[model samples]
Target chain A: MFRDIAEWLANSPAREFSAGLLSSIPGLPPILQTVHLLSIVAIMASIVLIDLRILGLAVPSQQLDEMIVRLRAWTVWGVIGAIISGILFVLARPNRYLLNPVFQIKFILLIGVLILTVCFYRWSAKNPFSHEPGNNIGIAKGVAVVSLLMWIVVVMAGRWIAYSEYLFWPG
Target chain B: MLNEFFLWLEYLPLAQHIGATWWFPLMESLHVVSMTLMLGTILMVDLRILGFAANRYAISTMSSELVPWSAVSLTIASVTGVAMFITRASTHAVNPALQIKMLLMVLAAINIVTVHCYVFRGVVNWDAGKVAPFSARFSAGCSLGLWVGVFLAGRWIGHIV
Candidate 1:
C-alpha cells in the first residue's frame, strides 16, 4: 500500500515538474539540502530551549509562559522553513526518498514528534509551571526526554537515508 | 608544512583504522550530532542577544545557561571532526570547501572572543529585557552569519572532495 502511494505520488504532475526543474538546475539538491539543514538548526534551537525549560535544566530566571510564547514563534517559523525545503528536497528525487526505508522511518518519526510537540505545548499551557516558573514534575520531564530522544532518532534516520541500501526498486 | 603534517598523520594506525573500519560513519554521525547541538544553542543565545527572539529572558541568564552546553558540544564536535579529518587528511587538506570552512570557524572563534572580551564585559549593564548595545548585537549577528557560512561550507565539502 505504501509503495502504491509512493508510486502514485511519483507519477504526479507536480512531482514530475519538480523533478524536471531540480534536475535542470545545477547544484539544486545540495542547495536544498543546505537550506533543509539550516531549517533543522532553527527548529532544534527553539525545541532544545523549550525542552530544557520543561526539564528544569536552564533559564531559571525567565517565566515559562513567556519563553514558550517567544520560542513558539521561532519554532513555527523553523517548521515552516523545514517543511518547504524538505518538500523541495523530496520532490527533487521522489524515488530516492520515497523508496528508502530510512526515509519512511524518518517520516513516521517526524509525525510522531510533531504530535508529541503539540501535545507537550498544550500540556505546558495548562500546567502550573508555565505560569509559576519553577522545576517541572515527573510527567513534564518525561515528555521532554521523549521529545529530545525522538527528534534525535528522526535526525539519525534522516542521515541514514543516504546510507540505506534497501530501496523500493534499488537505485 | 601543514600538508606534510596532514599526510604524515594520515598513515598513523588510528587514522588507517578509522578509514578502513565503520568508525568513519560513526564519527561522522557524532560530528554532525555535536554540530547540531552546538549550532542550535549558539543560534538561540545569539538570537536572544540580538533582541530577535526570547526577549523575555535576561541576556546574562540566557548566556550563562546556554553557552556551557554549546561549549560542551563544540568540544565533542571538534574532537569528532578532527578524528574524521585524520582519516582522510590528505584529501581534506586540498579541499577548498574545507579550507573555507576552517577559516570561517576561526573567524567565528574570533567573533566569540570579541564578544567575551568587549560586549560581555558590559553585559550587566544591558542584561535585562532591553536590547543589547550596538556592539553586542552586531557581534551576535556576525556570529550567526559566520556559523551559517561554516555550515554551508561544511556541506559543500562533500561535493568538492
Candidate 2:
C-alpha cells in the first residue's frame, strides 16, 4: 500500500513540477532546509522551556499557563513552517522519501510527537502543575522526559534520511 | 601555519576514523541537536529581554535560569563542531561559510558582553513586565540576527564545499 501510494505520488504532475522547480533554482533546497531547521529550533526551544518548567528544573516561579501562552505562537508557527517546507521536500522527490524506511520512521515519530504535544497541552491545561508545584508531577515529568527524548530522536531520524542506505537494522 | 595545523588535525586517529566511518553523520546529528538547544534557550532569553515573550518573568530571573542551558549546549555544540571540522580540517578551514560563521560567533559574543556589562547593569530597573530600554532591545535584536546568520552560514559550509 505504501509503495503504491509512493509510486502514484511520484508519477503525479505535482511532483514533476516540484522537481523541476527545485532543480531550476540555484540553492533553493538548502535555503528551504535552513528554514526548516530554524523552525525546528523554535519548536524545540519552546518545548524545552515548557518541559523544564514541568520537570521543576527551570523557571519554577513562572506559571505554566503563562509560559504556554508566551510560547504558543512560536510552536504553532514553527509547525506550520516545518510542514510547508517538509511537504515541498517530499514533493521534490517523492520516491526518495516515501520509499525510504528512515523517512517512514521520521514521519511516524513526527506524528507521534505532534499528537503527544496536543495531548500534553490538553492535560496540562486541566492539571496546571506549576501552580501547585511538587503536588502531582510524576505523570507530567514522565511526559516531559518522553517528549524531550522523542524530539531528539526525531531530529536524528530526520538527519539519517539521507544516509538511510547505511543504516544497520535487523532483517 | 594554519594549513599545517589543519593537516595535523586531519591526520589524528579520531579525525581519520570519523571521516572514514559513520561517525561523521553521528557527530553531525549531535552538532545539530546541541546547536538547536543552544539557539532555542538563547532565543527565549533574547525575546524576554526584548519584552516580546514571557514578559511577566523578570529578565534577570529568565536569564539566570535559562542561560545555563545555553552555556552547556554551546559547549557541546563547540565540541561536536570541532570534531566535525577536524574530519575535513584543511578544506573546512578555508571555507568561506565557516569563516563567516566564526565571525558571526565573535560578534555574537561581543553583543552578549555589551548586554552584560552595560545594558544589563540597569536591568534591575525594568526587569519585570516592562519594555526594556532601547539599548537592551537593540542588543537583543542583534543577538537574534547574528545567531540566525551563524546558523545559516554553518549550514552553507556543506553546500559551498
Candidate 3:
C-alpha cells in the first residue's frame, strides 16, 4: 500500500514539475541542502537546551517558562524551515528517496518526533515549571531523554540515506 | 610553508588507512555530530548574550553551564576535522571553502578570547535580564555570524572538492 502511494506520487505532475525546475536551476539543490542543514542545527540547538534544562543539567537557576518562551519562536521557525526544505529536497528526487530504506526510516522518525514535540509542549503547558524544579523531575527527564533519542535517530537516518547501499526498487 | 607539512600529512599511515576504509565515513559522521553539539551550545550562549533568548538567566551562569560542553565538543570536532584533513591534505589545503572556514574559525576564536578577557570582566553589572552592553552584544553578534559562516563554508567544501 505504501509503495503504491509512493509510486503514484512519483509519477504525479507536481513532482515532475518540481523536479524539472529544481534540476534546471544551477545550484538550487545544494543551496536547499545547506538551508536544510542550518535548519537542523537551529532545531537541535533549541531542543538540546530545553532537554538539558529538563534534565536539570543546564540553566538550573532560570525558570523553565522563561527559557521556553524565548526559544519558542526559534523552534517554530526551525521546524517550518526544515519541513519546507525537506519537501523540496524530496521533490527533487522522489524516486530515489521513496524506495530508500534509510529515507523511509527518517520519514517515520520525523513523524514520531513531531508527535513527541506536540505532546511535550502540551505537557509543559499544563504543568508550568518554575525555579523549584518540580516534584515530577523524573517524568520531565524521561521526556527529555526520549525527545533527544528520537531526534538523534531522525538525524542519523537522514544522513545515512545517502550512504546506504539500497537506493532504488527493483523493477 | 605549511604546504610541505600538509604534504607530509597526506602520506601518514593513519591518513591512508582512513582513506582506504570505512574509517572516513565513521570519522565524518563523528565530525558532524561534534560540530552540531559545539555549535548548538555556542549558539545558546551567544543568543543569551545578544539579549535574544533566555533573558531571565544570568549570562555568567549560562556561560559557566554551557561553555564547558562546547569546549569538549570543540576538542572532539577539531580532532576529527584534522583527521579528515590529513587524509586529503593537498586537496583541502588549497580548497577555498576550507580556507575560509579555517580563517573564520580563527576569527571566532579571537572573538571568544577578546570577550572573555575584556568584555566579560564587567559582566556582573549586566549579567541578569538586563541587555548586554554594546561591546558584549557586538562580540555575540560576531560570534553568531562567524560560526554560521564556518558551518556554511564547511558544507560548501564537499561541493567544491
Candidate 4:
C-alpha cells in the first residue's frame, strides 16, 4: 500500500509544487512554527481555564455559560493555527507521510475527535452549568482525562515517526 | 544522564528500522493528529468552563461528553509512539530536546491529575447562572500553562539535536 503511494507521489506534480512553494517562501517553515505555537498556547489557555472551572479553581462566582463564550475565540484561533501549520508540514513531505500507516491512523483519529467535540459543543448550547460547579463531575473529569491522554499519545507518535520503516517479505 | 542507556538501546534492530526508513515519519504524523484532537477538545472544555461557548450545559459536560474521543486518539498515538522510541532509544534518550519533551509530558500529566483529584470532586449544581469554584479556576489556569508548554515541546522535537 505504501509503495503505491510513494510511487504516485514521486511521479506527481504535487510534490514539485510543495517543494517549490516551500523553497520560494524562504523562512516560511520557522515562521509557521511560531504562529502554530502561539495559537496552540492560546487554545490550551482557554481549555485549562474551563477545566479548572470544572475542578473549581478560578472565578467561582462567574456564570459557566459566560466563561464558555469567552473561551470560544481562543479555540477557533487555535484550530486555525493547527490547520495552517499542519498543511505546511504535510506539504513538505507528502509522499513519506501518505505512505505511512501511522499518518493514516492520525487522520482517522482526527476525524473522530472533531465529530465528538461538535456533539458536546452543540449539546451544551441548551443546558447551562449550574452554580454548584460540581453538578456534572463525571463528564468534566472524563473530558480532561481524554484530552491529556490524547495529546501525550500524539507527541510520542510524532517523535516515533522519525523511526518508521516498511519492508514486504518475499512471497 | 539516561542518554547513555538510550544510546545503547537505539542500537537494537527496531531502532535501526525506525531510523533507516519511513516508520518514524509515519508515527509523527499520527502524533500531530492526536495533538490536534487533544488541543481542540481541551479548548472546547475550557471555553465551556469560562462561559464562552457551551453555556447551556453543565461544567462536567465538557469532560464526560467531549473528552472520550480525545482519550482514544491519545491511546492510539501513545502505542505507536512507544514503538518509535524502541526504534531509536539510545539516540533520543540522549537528545536534550527529547528529554525536555519528556519532562514537559510528566508535568502536564501532573497538572491534569491535580485538576481531577483536588477540584470538581463532586456535583456542582448551578444556582441561577453561576460559574465554577475559585480553586477550580486556579486549577484551570495551571492546566492551561502546562498544556501549552507540552504542545510547544512536542513541536520542537522536530528540531531536536
Candidate of highest DockQ: 2
Report the TM-score measured on chain A for model 4: 0.72
Sorted into a CAPRI-style docking class, model 2 comes out as medium
> DockQ for model 4?
0.14
Chain A TM value for model 2: 0.90
Which has the higher DockQ value, candidate number 1 or candidate number 4?
A: 1
Give candidate 1's error at residue B66 in angstroms.
0.8
* lDDT string, candidate 4, A34-53, tens digits: 56656654554555445555
| Residue pairs whose backbone atoms clash in candidate 1 | none
Model 4 segments more than 4 A misplaced: A1-31, A37-171, B1-4, B125-130
Model-by-model DockQ, in order:
0.54, 0.68, 0.46, 0.14
Chain B only, TM-score of each candidate: 0.97, 0.97, 0.96, 0.82
DockQ of 3: 0.46
Chain A TM-score vs. truth, each candidate: 0.86, 0.90, 0.88, 0.72
Q: Considering every candidate listed, which one attains the maximal TM-score?
A: 2
What is the per-residue lDDT of model 1 for residues B98-148, given as tens digits with 9 covering 90 to 100?
A: 999999999999999999997899787889866789999899999989998
| Model 1: per-residue Cα lDDT over A1-171, one tens digit each | 557767887888878788887789877766776777777777777786678777777666667667776678767887787788788667656778887888888898899999888887787778767454445567777888988888777766777777675233355
User: Candidate 1 docking category?
Assistant: medium
- Residue-wise C-alpha lDDT for candidate 3, range B1-161, written one tens digit per residue: 78889889999999999887767766776777677778878888898899887777789998998898899889988998998899999999899999999999999999999998999998889889668999999999999899888888888888888
Q: Cα miss at B54, model 2 (Å)?
A: 1.0
The top-ranked prediction according to lDDT is 2
TM-score, candidate number 3? 0.89
True contacts kept of 2: 0.58
Candidate 3 Cα misplacement greater than 4 A, ranges:
A24-26, A130-135, A166-171, B1-4
Query: Model 1, chain A: how large is the TM-score?
Result: 0.86
